[model samples]
Target chain A: MDADVRQMTWTELAALCTNLEKACTKQLKEEEARAFASLASFYASKRKAQGDASLDDLLALIEADLSTGYRSANEAANYADDRGAKRALLWGEKATKLLKSLLARYAKQKEALTADTGVFVCEICGFVYVGQQPPEVCPICKVPSFKIHEVKKEAI
Target chain B: MHAARNLRLCTKDCVCLFICPTGATNTETGQIDFDKCLDGCRLCVDACPSGAIYLVSSTYPAPQPKHPSVLETLYSLVRSKAAQEDVAHSVKEGSDDAALRQICTVVETSSRIIAEDLWRESGYIIAQSEATRALLKAMISEHGTMEGFPRTEVEELLSRLS
Candidate 1:
């Protein structure tokens, strides 16, 4: 797995991780699950070895591209004078802002944060909030406490 | 093009109402009536105190499809994200921990959204790809035989693409 991943370019590896991400979301057959596990391990191993390499930057760039959807949606809404489209874009913009904020926080505190500290993400909107406990209500998506989930910062 | 209000951001200052020449900006709904709005008039957009109003075009030109390689990469990502979402769903099912369950659900939802976004970017969405024209043509030919298919719209798009 290591040798295979090593042979690929950083872009290719990133693409693999991205594809794996989507594949993991769908209902997986046992064979696919094993394949996913192998790929996930390979990705993790590569990232650990590379340490702040181009792959890391590529992932960030990919995540940041979520904003493009908001921009286009807003433009479409404006063109057609569609209030529903605009409202959907508004939610999307809020979610994007939350993602940016979470990323910024993670970057700023990467050095200071310990393994024990919790990173909460809102289930309804994917809003990442770093702290011991999730917020009472997600500021972005307005999901309640039951909807907030704590994840390892590394996993996020 | 005309100005419209995002009511969520509107502070109800009524500056848009004051600035709009055609009285398109209304206090009741805190929205601009598109029928009454003057084309290319942006007075309300410029004068909105809360920055809630902005001008937008009524229609946009067809967007060129991205490079084939870029489109392929996006499609690959869409599948990848779907895979991850499945993993999250499975984890959510077994987890007794509330926070963990919540996190898994969120991951699943977000991954799906990302996957859909990539799919849209991968030359499948209308107004963003010539591939859409082809797809429309194929779908109409295959499915239009069933009934209720908007064969006319598909025909128009095919002609436009040609």
Candidate 2:
């Protein structure tokens, strides 16, 4: 019998999360394309909410980034490398960068993301960006700009 | 750090097996023997043609505990993503379009990832609070009679917590 999630060790949780990421990667590649509009929206809203929430200010968000965000990215990166999936590795790296950048900006008393800087999303690897244009080559998946879409950041 | 082989990408070229100084790669199970692997030796990682071998860190960084308020925010996000995932799953079920299915799958995957992050940081695993105890007790009550619930492990966990 499988142990309950709460009872499982950190290693078990890591393995399960890695399997989830690997399965997600397989689906994206086999389908020949991908879409992350809903996922991206979910994350953007979460980030915005964290920024707006008054519970202990940015400390809560910073702590979460240090604990959950960084660890998740590490697990995903290792799993992606093991599975030989460059796209998955890139997405994990992006997640780590997002967390670090947020922490840095918040520490300096600046907004992590500005209203004018648009969100550029990679269709293949779900890498999100706030920039003037999509990158020449996606750092995560190495895909060209054609595969990256400029998403609306007005609401977020 | 020592090299570990990813069997999925391993072409059975035996490159790692030949390159490993400690014979850690020439195992019956096809996995490198971590105990025998030399520290900082990445010979197999470099020699592998398929890029399957990579160095893994044996020691993980210390856990940074997040504040409960942060956990609350994460829980809210998890709930939102979970609801979105449910909607996408339903849409995928109802639609015949391949594109829709693919989109739904991506949504579902991302939602799961977010959910897992919340779960990890929620203090649900450490038995540190009443909430964790309550959750375990509830699970025991609900699935204690079920055959596949790992009742013994659950009971053991509950006992230790108590």
Candidate 3:
């Protein structure tokens, strides 16, 4: 479903999740789970170790958590809907509750990372960097992060 | 050209309506469609003559705090190590904790760098319109160019969401 488009059929989504949950947990269905897991890798893999990784590793855990949470949700929602699928709407309702909790936790973590530009200054000419950390040597003053002044003063 | 800004400046002379080349500049509505405008054509931007039609590039995102001074990011990589230090200091007692903590740090630092890159790439806004300009600006800057950003693994979720 395109998120840009509004509205969805709760029954279809819940059914998808139920099948997804089953596929994710059992050994016979491991390959199917792996495929779904791969879909999730897009969001999870960015945070993994790399030559010049930026996001702290927490992204992967959240990604993984979302996968499981979603799978669990699909299963529960399916159960709720299965009484003749009349309960399909209820399943979607449950899914919302499940996701909101997860979203709140993720939001807190994301807020911390994005609260500021995550920039700092060179102690010398007071040069600032917005990426990960200050350079090994300040291009301007040829000083180190140690020598450069940190913008964040301890509000003493 | 200053669609929204000129909304403030227009004396309702409606001179812009006559000067605009493709009618890309709208006086009554106070909007200009960059997508509709020719690249580097500067007709509307030039037509405004109010100096209000600030030539805007469609490539970047919405305006941000302290637009990207590539110099700044380079400075960070060259001077700071708070990210590395944060990683080093998080000594998890258990194996799982250690691994989880490590991943968290990696994601955090990566997001920070990405945020910087995104901020820089997305900071171009128009002085022209505001109708959907601000909305589109937020969409573009956070999202990216109309041709759009690459389908990187990092942005895969967003792509899916879209």
Question: Per-candidate TM vs. native?
Answer: 0.45, 0.39, 0.24
Report lDDT (CA) for all predictions. 0.51, 0.49, 0.35
DockQ: which candidate is best? Answer: 1
Whole-model lDDT, model 1: 0.51
Q: For all the predictions, what are the DockQ values?
A: 0.05, 0.04, 0.02
List the lowest-lDDT window of 10 residues for candidate 2 chain B: B120-129
A1-156 in candidate 1: lDDT tens per residue?
Answer: 011322333233333434433433332222333433443344334322222222234235436445454455455556656554444345545654554454455446543543456766565445666568877887875767876776652322
Over the stretch A1-156, how does candidate 2's per-residue lDDT look in tens digits? 113545433222332333333333332221111111222232233321111232132334434544665455445435434332222333543643553453344346433344446555565555556568878997766887887776442210
Regions of model 2 farther than 4 Å from truth:
A1-156, B1-3, B6-21, B27-30, B34-61, B95-99, B117-144, B147-162
Better of 2 and 3 by DockQ: 2
Docking class of 1: incorrect
i-RMS of candidate 2? 14.0
B-chain TM-score, every candidate? Answer: 0.67, 0.52, 0.33
Over A12-124, each residue of candidate 3 has an lDDT whose tens digit, in order, gives 11222222323233222344444334432322322223344322332333344335533443354354442312122223223223323333443466435324434454432
Question: Using TM-score as the measure, which candidate wins?
Answer: 1
**CAPRI rating of model 2:** incorrect
Candidate 2 is scored at a TM of 0.39
**Model 2 pairs whose backbones collide:** A90-A140
